[model samples]
Target: MYDYVKGQVTRITPEYIALEVQNIGYQLFTPNPYAFRVNEQIQLVYVHMHVREDAHTLYGFTSLEQRELFRKLIQVSGIGPKGALAILASGAPTHVIQAIEMEDEAFLVKFPGVGKKTARQMILDLKGKLGTLMDVVELPSTEDELPLFGMNPYGHELEEAMLALIALGYSEKELAKVKPQLEEDEALTTTDAYMKQALKVLLKMK
Candidate 1:
């Protein structure tokens, strides 16, 4: 029902961000909630609404291209919304598109919950369909180093990053393997930074 939401980010949690508009808060589950900063200036978030008998959910993205890629992902067999979110959480939609186009099942299966069968199905279903999105897919920086920021004394940033990864279907066991490393990395001060580093570690573990 919502094409986009224009509002200030009033709150952010591991699972979702609350965009307050007209005295109401709309909870939007995104691939990366930390990508948005709380109390930031008003912005437009393109949204996709998924409705079921049990509940209605809204998945938000920074751009329409991201939303479109998400929509396409969910249509693939064996891939649900959460799985799609996990794929996007890598922050490398360009890489995903390249994998799909190249029929590289190895790259696609690296994401949590994606098996070899699902990977092949994704290629069979979406290979030629994603060409248009390639031009618009935002390529994330290839740098291994992320910008540093002031650390939260309570360690809420790292905790939130962990929770977001769990919500994306990563197991606690997998996170346990990386938590110490994340805590030890002084450069990861912001939740976004922690998330990026954690994802890199998790992908490497695969």
Candidate 2:
């Protein structure tokens, strides 16, 4: 029933965000919750309201394309809201689209709860149906090249950036190669700054 919510981010967790709009806090589960900051002003999230017999849940996304992809994923028989969320959690929807278009069952199976049968089912259901979203599909050059979700500001910036990068599907091996450059950058002071610089370094490595 809800298309989107515009408000301030009052709280953020690894899995969800509490967005306060007009004196009410609406909990929204997003693919990249850490990408948001606590108390951020005037954030807009495209949302999906999932109603089940036992509960009603809100899934949110930063962009329209992300929300649209989530909707399509859940329409597949074997993929539920949680499973779809796991697929989107990688912060790289482009790769998902690419896998579907290429009929890459092995790549699709990497997401949690997706098996050989489910992967094939996804391809069967969505392969040629994905529309305009295809125009925006740009795969990450390297795993770390996926966009950086912002990190906690209270802790060590570099440490938080590393955690966010890891959550975005970057391997420890890739991170180790760039950690020194990030640490040695004397001008970088905030998690956002570190995240941006780290993304630049990672993209350069690609």
Candidate 3:
């Protein structure tokens, strides 16, 4: 029922964002909730409203490109919204588009929930359709990497994060570029936090 909301970002939790639009707060679940800034202006969030027997949910994206990709992803036989979100969470839409186009089932299945059958189905279903969205895909490269961890960080945390990214389907080259940016932060610990940070970095690059 909603197209988009232009408002101030009042809150950001790990899973969702609260935007105050015209004195109302809209809770929006995104692929990565960290992508928004508190008090920043947002525009044109293409949305998907999911209604279940017990509840109603609204998911939002900054751009129609991401929403379109999300829509196509969930249409696959074995993929669901959560699974599709995880796939989108990786922040490398171009690689995903490429994987679909190239029929790279091996590569596509590396995401958190994707399997060989689902990957093949993604290719069969969305290969040619995602071409225009290729421009929106952002694979992090060396020169244009985003900051991952906090300032003055340790190498181990970044390394572990890289491992997690690899486990999440990022390539060595892509991880290498972002590693320095992540290493700059000293406060982070454990692979999970690193995974979160890594995803944030990857998404920003996108």
Q: Alpha-carbon error at 63 in model 2, in Å?
A: 1.0
| Candidate 2 lDDT, 111-144, residue by residue in tens | 6678999999999999889988999976444343
Residues 71-118 of candidate 3: C-alpha lDDT, one tens digit per residue = 888888888888877777653455677667667676676577777878
Candidate order by lDDT, decreasing, is 1, 2, 3
Better model by TM-score: candidate 1 vs candidate 3: 1
Model 1 weakest lDDT span, ten residues long: 145-154
Candidate 1 has an lDDT of 0.79
C-alpha lDDT (0 to 100) for residue 37 of candidate 2: 75
RMSD of each: 10.1, 10.4, 10.8
| Poorest lDDT segment (10 consecutive residues) of candidate 3 | 145-154
Model 2 TM-score, all chains together: 0.69
Please report the TM-score between candidate 3 and the true structure. Answer: 0.65
Query: What clash pairs does model 3 have?
Result: 150-185, 153-184, 153-185, 153-186
The CA root-mean-square deviation of candidate 1, after full C-alpha superposition on the true structure, stands at 10.1
